[model samples]
Target: MTGGNWLGLSGKTIVVTGGSGGIGRAILRGALDAGARVVVLDYDAKTAEETAREADSAGCLAIGLGCDVSDTDSVAAAAEAVAERWGGCDVLINNAGILRPGPLEDLSLEDWTRMLDVNLNGCLIGSQIFGKQMVERGGGAIVHVASISASQPQPFSGAYSPGKAAVAMLSRQLAYEWGPKRIRSNVISPGLVLTPLSEAFYKDEDVRRARERLVPVGRIGRPQDMADVALFLASDRAAYVNGQEIVVDGGLSQTLMGTVPRPGYSG
Candidate 1:
């Protein structure tokens, strides 16, 4: 795998939602590094600016866009902008998601809906809008960022897990419907990556070690780890890898850690 590149997306236009997030930025960087034009759609303008600047410095065409993937009108406008600016993207990476962590007992309906709005519905809307264009232009690729929580359970994972699980199923449905048009769809479930979202837990050495023990990989996931897989799924190299949910969490999912939370002990 190290001997050569996965696939070249040169001359391709890509749209990366939540491009400002930890893994989102990494995916954008990977695609841009591959000489592809990327449109970064992020909710936070500041973070989006940073991503766009980095891509621009790399001499790649990257547009920083503010978009609310949950809102119909918002997504419509964002998609329009992407189509207008890039004349349609060849790849659409739905990486935008929010984690509202709270005990199921204390969680509110508003919290649950918000999580679904951005995580599941957002991607669904993006797929419909962008997939139409891709289908018209012959074909395209869509890689969604799901979570191991979708399959495995974590404490206080109520909304996040269910929402992500829905996203995985959504990808499967989209794949089935869009495959005839050569529009491939896939999902990536990443485990405990050291991202801004998860940095609080890792900030404490003891906590970090405890978290690592839970992952059979002996360490938490990395942004680049997910990015590498994403690059493959988005490129022509993964043309045959459609409707598949590739869990890129090292060997964490394979290990059964049991009910008790044990620190510094990798199964």
Candidate 2:
């Protein structure tokens, strides 16, 4: 679908953090295709500008702004910019995050703090800043990009799962607290997705196939998979859906029982 405005997002303003690349970028494009003006927020200003330039086209407005979601001042400035340019944001997608792998036993305090700052605190900061705009506008949707690992802990990922878990709960808290204000908060927990950051791992054909077999859908997830769902959650069609965590893992999360050795139970 190419900016058909079927999602009813035409003229709506969308702010996406960490949208320079990966699933965030996919969501940015999806929002543009839905006919919404989008603002890309990334730590790297140059890359963000380049991405915005690439995604911009006729009938669609997209711009890039440098931001560190964990920094209140930075996000506040971005929010102010959005307000000045397009009045305020209609949809806020918190997709910026980082992963530092290390055993919990040996994880450094610095790494742990950094992960939480970006992965957990970042979401809260964005919601608070942009959420006010949504409140002033009467109502809006907030989509947080979490990870399936939020529920299922992944070893060697320093603070990643913990931070994500916190993010899920924080989203729910926001939903309950802000629901009466007409602001809806939701989370999207993605499974194993192949993004630019993880592209190197999938370069090995064997590695790719091995991972694909784990998902019941028989394929590794692409960025578009998450983007499709995000578009829905951000649209008015999902007005009734709030504070829910939509797991886009291709049924991979349900395979835990199948992982157990059931000799006679298996057909």
Candidate 3:
């Protein structure tokens, strides 16, 4: 996408966690296309800087910093860097996350804690740190990239679902507590997206088709799909959209009834 000022983000400073790749990278690119100065925070410093350099080639002002969102000191440093470079953050996208698959019966405490640290605690930490910048700047928007598993249980995914579920609630709590401070918080729950992390699953044509059949849209989601929504949520266009969870699942969540045995109603 070409850089433009259509979303009124021309001079805005947008910070995206996990911005080195996948949906996070997409959001970073989208923000850049909208003419916003973007910061990429990822656990891998080199990868983050590479992504930033790529964006720079497109004439966008972007910087990549190593950050472990689960760590307060790491996040605080990243926030400070943003403040030093851009003065303050206008938008923050909490997109860094991890998944550890294991049955609940056999799940280890370490795995559970790790999942929560990244998926749940990371969100809070990022919000609190950058949120202060927003408070000082008068107001800002926060867009969290949660999973559809937040509402529906995905068995064998250890603490992935529970952690995400908490993130949804956390978003609401932040919205309520910070709305008065002009800090709007919202979440985007995505389903079946094809990214570097999930590319192995889609490599199998049969599995890919089977998954696609389950979605009403007849295809899996792309990073751009999530990025488009993030762009809107972070932009002033969605100023009134707060404490809300937008499910970008290609209408799959609404198809649960199709699995039930409804005999005489064949259309």
lDDT winner among the candidates? 3
Q: Model 1, range 1-267, lDDT digits (tens) per residue?
A: 221244768778888999988888888778877878888888876677777987687534888888889988887888788788778878999999987889999899999899999999999999988888898778999999998999876679658888888889999999998899999999999987999887888879999898788776699899999988988899988889889999988787886746557787534
Give lDDT tens digits, candidate 3, residues 95-173.
Answer: 9999899999999999999999999999999999999999999999999999899998999999999999999999999
TM-score of every candidate = 0.91, 0.96, 0.97
Displacement of residue 17 (Cα, Å) in model 3 is 0.5
Flag regions of model 1 displaced more than 4 Å. 1-6, 58-60, 257-267
Error of 1 at 83 (Å): 1.6
lDDT of 2 at 62: 96
The superposed Cα distance between candidate 3 and the true structure at residue 148, in angstroms, equals 0.8
TM-score of 3: 0.97
Give candidate 1's TM-score.
0.91
Candidate 3 achieves a global lDDT of 0.92
Question: After superposition, which runs of candidate 3 have C-alpha atoms over 4 Å from their true positions?
Answer: 1-4, 58-60
